[model samples]
Target: MSKVRGTNTLPEMRVRRALHSMDYRFRLHRPDLPGKPDIVLQKHRVCIFVHGCFWHSHPGCVRATTPESNGEFWAKKLAGNVERDRRSALELAEMGWRVCVIWECETRYTDALVLAVNRCMKHSGPISL
Candidate 1:
């Protein structure tokens, strides 16, 4: 678990790279937020979260498997992550912020990832990617 990273993850980096290429600048991990969002666009009232399938327990995700050993611990940990994410998203929404979650599985498909990012960015403004 030591190798597990919570920030600057592969999917996050891919999205960051794509956004940067498009000349879209954003803040990384704003601490003031409830969940410390991975990317923040202050001007657009947007925040992005890059979640791991296993960690966040993505619904219907095959990668989100319960550990055979210490299943209870894993379950508790994963559940907490999910609950925190939900609460944070809710809080951000209540504050008029748009939240986008980029899952680990999404990284396997760059085109889809790009489209998702573009769609979010569309609400902010036109960007060249």
Candidate 2:
């Protein structure tokens, strides 16, 4: 829909805020990047994508439920999103950039989101739940 936004979304903002609070600096949606990642830490060579569960079709996510109306269209659209995501991530990885995909559901827990950012930054130590 026209109301749908592709950037600065609530989930993306949540991740950005958490990372900023952790003293991490990042760039927002660099067009040069494969996917114009939500957060790009050039120093750390990491790219973060804050994907909506419904939009990106997050596996096993309740929010990913398909719409009853226009079933075929929604399925096709969602599937394309997933495919493009995978291709973009692969391309970024091949280009030597560490890619991190944080689903909308994961953004609900700031602590976990922070941990995921840290992990993507390659900080040492176990990633406990």
Candidate 3:
């Protein structure tokens, strides 16, 4: 567990790079907000969360499996992660912030990831990015 990383992960970097290439500007992890979203486009009131499949318990994701040993502990820990994520997303929504979660598995495909990001931004509003 010592090697587990919470921020600046490869998946997060991939998303950041895609945003930059698309000429979108953003801030990294604003502590003042709930969950400290991985990327924030303050001007557009958008927050991006780059969630690991296992950590955030991505539904139907193969990588989100748990070990047989200490299964109880793993289940509880993963459940807690999901709960916290849900709360944070809700809070951000209440604050009128648009939240986007880019899963780690999705980052594996660069082209698709870019399109996904673009689509997400489009839904946010009339932004000239």
Candidate 2, residue 48: Cα displacement in angstroms equals 0.2
Q: TM-score for all predictions?
A: 0.88, 0.91, 0.92
Deviating ranges (above 4 Å) for candidate 3: 123-129
For residue 74, give model 3's deviation from the true position in Å.
0.4
Candidate 2 lDDT by residue in tens digits, 1-129: 999999999999988888787678999999998888999999888999999999999899899999999999999999999999999999999999999888888888867776776777787874433
Instruction: Summarize candidate 3's per-residue lDDT along 1-129 as a digit string, tens digits.
Output: 999888889999888888897788999989999999989998889999999998889989999998789999999999999999999999999999998888899889876686668766875533222
Against the reference, the lDDT scores of all candidates come to 0.85, 0.87, 0.87
Ranking of all predicted structures according to TM-score, beginning with the best and ending with the worst:
3, 2, 1
Candidate 3 local lDDT, residue 115: 61
Better of 1 and 3 by lDDT: 3
**Where is model 3 poorest over a 10-residue stretch in terms of lDDT?**
120-129
All candidates: CA RMSD (Å): 2.3, 2.3, 3.0
